[model samples]
Target: MKTFFQELKNRRVYRVAITYVIAGSATVQVVGTVLPIFHAPDWVQQVFVALVAFGFPVALVLAWCFDLEDGAIKMTCGDGRAVVTSRRVWILAGVGLLVAGSALTGYWLWHPWKRLSDAASMSSDTLSAPPVIEKSIAVLPFENLSDDKQNAYFADGVQDEILTDLAKVADLKVISRTSVMQYKTSAQRNLREIAKALGVAHILEGTVQRAGGRIRVSAQLIDARTDMHLWAERYDRDLADVFGIESELAQQIVSQLKSKLSAREKAAIEQKPTADLAAHDLYIRAKTLIASSALSTPQAESLLEAVHLLNQAVERDPAFARAYYQLAEAHDLLYLQGIDHTPARLAMADGAIQSLARLRPNSGEAHLAFAKHFYWCYHDYDRAREELTLAQKSLPNDPLPFQLAGYIDRRQGRWPESIKNLERAIELDPQNSAFLEQIARSYECLRRYVDAERALDRAIALVPKDAAMRARRAEIELHWHADARPLMSTIQAIIAKDSREGKNIAELWLYGLLCERDFDGALRALAALPIDGCHQETILFPRVWCGGIVARMRGDTASARAAFTSARNELAKLVREQPAYAEALCALGMADAALGHKEDAIREGRRAAELLPVAKDAIVGPLLVQNLALIYAWTGEKDLALEQLSIAAKLPGYLSYGQLRLHPYWDPLRGDPRFEKVVASLAPK
Candidate 1:
């Protein structure tokens, strides 16, 4: 072993090995970075590294067989025929180099190809023998083939009906409508690509054509892996027979996909929602229009039009349960949109829901609508939970029920349960931005700010043009983290590109300025806002509140009093109209507190807390209680304030260390040890 080592040293093999390694590493590094820029295939870089590695052994063998002499490579002489051996060594070295180069080049080229072939075989094996999933399917939007493009709603209605029926089957994994409709207006991609994106094994594609009193639907089921049509059918039916067509299509698809259906599911599929074709048509049109309206920016005109259409639908067929449910949805949305957040509109929604319940005693749609009404209007969390449970039972496959359940859990401070329910909804409706945002809200309540930001980022990616999402992201950074500089550029860009989103951007700027205690900047932001009468209650309310705070900060008592009085009066009117409105009462309390009306502030704040007690309203409960605590702190009721703060800190709500540190309302509490402990409790883990 020692002689072998000495021979290696004598031949300078170590030097050759080190040199080869250094050169090989440099070559690999260079190729790895440069080849990618030229859009070279990954295999090209792999082959280069493999070739360099191959040269290492060849170089070492050459070092052992030859010696560097007089700046030239010469074969070693150990025998009598030194000249002959040197000549033969040169020839053999040349042959060895040629063979090794060829061999390495061949291996580099062939080895990856072989491994890739094996990988492909394995992939194919896994795909062919996929883990058992319950008959997963994605039903692409049916093509509208009518002369009048307005008939697109009719096509969507038919497709939705079929999907609705299929979703009732417990043994099937049906992707929700939101994800499936994304392919409707967009350019179609490969069927397999669509299927893979939806996490389904089968694809349902079809076209719909409607004439005066007749409807034509052509549907085919395909194996997503091979894009092979499993079944094809064409139905030419009377307009009134459309429900039957949907039922039959659903049955055929189930059979083709080999999914089992219980007796109840079969019964549900066979039942017709409405026998009157006119009522059905009107309901579908209203539903299509209502679906297009924005929930956050509800237009009164659009909602009124849908209401008119839905009213006509129910009048045409008084017993049409689906029409009644859609009518309720339109009414509820009209009120929810806050375009018509009046008692009359809320009463109308209640009336519609009652009618729906009377018409369809066990309808999932009725239960879901009632759940919304109970949650948003009545604020009856327990009743809302019961309704949601019934809805889930009736619509086991519907994402709406699960989503609503998640929201109920969120508002009730069940953070983990809320997350689980929202995640379930995401599994059903994978591309829903609203679901993603709600999930972020749940994360926020849990103080999982990082996870919340990630969720918001995902929601923003899905809806890049959504001003609400951008505002939400800004709020998290500015108000929750007290870090708004990073998001300032984005806010400015959004405002510059679309002045219409200026109001939302300005609100973000105001929050950012407030976080920094920049009173002048806050006043400037308030000035730049476009406050119109239509949005005075929403847009102007914040401006007034901020203006009051900034004026007080600058020692302008008269201006502060005027601002606070203006905000208080407006909020007082809202509270008078809706006595149970916790948010309006809280705002009034905040205004009173700002004006130094200690007694009034305490009264209004306590009233707000009573209306939104933590036992019944987890979402607004903690916020209102915290507002009361702020007032108490400012009025020097240290014990009362600390008690509220401790309770608020324990709840899964929006209280945070940043808010405690930055909010001017809580400035008086900063010196208190109890306040510091409460804020410290929320420290990031």
Candidate 2:
């Protein structure tokens, strides 16, 4: 054994092995760092590792069989001799130093956890030890410090751009714009408390000022746990370099937090949305309006304003993909509001979507915009799902994409997946009422009333002043919980707080009265709302339908006939003005049925059903189908009513099983075995 070792040393095989390892490890370290910068595939690193391993044995064999004489390789004989010299030992020592350097480089390149402080790296053995969190952050709404308060939109735009840039970093958990906007003018919560509430390690607060053609931005990063200022900076730049300011701010945040950014993320952070500053400003302003108007008391008018603003933005810079995306979103809101369903509106929305696709082919916002158009406008569930999947890949950090995906899943009867996606969205925007509301609705669909109620309570807490939100919560209580007491008390309290805003809760008041079988109270609530004040088709249709139903329940046949005639006249005019208005046609059909015009009801209902077959998954389609079934039931067509009920039970539209069981419209078919089966199927397993 001693002779074999001597021979190996004499042949320089041991030196060769050490040298090869030192060179190979150094090469691996370099490759690891450089490959990621170039956005190289993961397999490239694997292949490099494999090649290094394969070369190790080849290097040793070459060292044993060949000798370098004047840099020329010549055959050499290995003999048992003490040929180890000090030169070779010193060379080995140098190789040892090289190995250590390579090891240090490899540690720096591959092991990120090593960079964390000992306190942050402590084991979680102690019960009282604080748990280590990832590089998570929340960028609070930037204060508008401009001389002109109207420049508030500009400040918001600046903050949003920074937050968006930071979100591109996968290593950082960025709280979304929706959740952060709650802090826009709020001063009640301390930094530490706000960070804890948002589940972030750091909080970013900033101020923006825009004057004439120049801009100034000041930002600071604070340690949420200790309330320590980690970093702060100020920037003065021309309006044209606004994108640079955002990119620099994002880079500074990443640097302060020691967050790693992938090549794609870096590119995304630096990519400017538009070259036209005016157009970009318009887009940002539109986004701000859209965000504020989402599910607000007067969302329709606000969305229309945003739509007009986005149109100007797109015309200014036809290549503005984000503007086009926002335009599509505005159209989607208009569609969902049932304010307009004209082909011209649909075509304009489609044009916006096409612009998004052309301008930003790989953008998540583009995919999300197209997905919304498909899901809401076209009711193409499969195509919407596919686009959403692509959107998820493109904008993995965005909660909106996941939220939309959840809605699509719910519409397609994929309850578990829907809940999962909605929950994920909540994780990203914990305080967002829109996401919370959708989650509650999804839970209601599964008949998980308790969970649904809990979600609604959270949403109501987030937006207590929102009458529409209050109405929805009251609805959940009335139908799902089969309890009118809570709904009555809640609606009364909301009304007592502010009578003007209380009008918005009239629908819920009517629902509560109906739940208690109090027709007179429902009529009173309907009178308070008054058709003249209710412009939303959703609210208007419901008011007219419930008013007629309440009058019928009270045995006031004349009042019931008058209400039905009014609703029929209004809906008929709407259908004539916009023949594409499927919901209006359905409303007209239901009104006709209520007035005992069975043939007219059938004709109108069939026309609605045939006008938009794709809308069966939308609110209008199932609503039309349900009303058509109501028409069939009123005319003594039990089989058709049960058939429509079964179809509606599976759709996202119409009432809950509890509502179906108690609704007066379905009472005509209540004793039928098929109706019972359909209602029974709605019960959660």
Model 2 TM-score (2 dp): 0.73
Candidate 1 lDDT score at position 47: 68
lDDT of each: 0.75, 0.75
Clashes of 1: 0
Tens digits of per-residue lDDT, candidate 1, 129-168, equal 2332548888889999988898887888888899999998
lDDT by residue for model 2 (277-359), tens? 88887998888888887555555677888998998998898888889999998887777666666677788888888888998
Task: Give the RMSD in angstroms, all C-alphas superposed, for model 2.
Answer: 21.5
For model 2 the local lDDT of residue 459 reads 80
- Candidate 1 — worst ten consecutive residues by lDDT sum? 531-540
In model 2, which regions exceed 4 Å deviation?
Answer: 1-132, 276-278, 528-559, 569-585, 603-625, 638-663, 666-685
Q: In candidate 1, which residue pairs get closer than 3 Å at backbone N, Cα or C atoms, i.e. clash? A: none
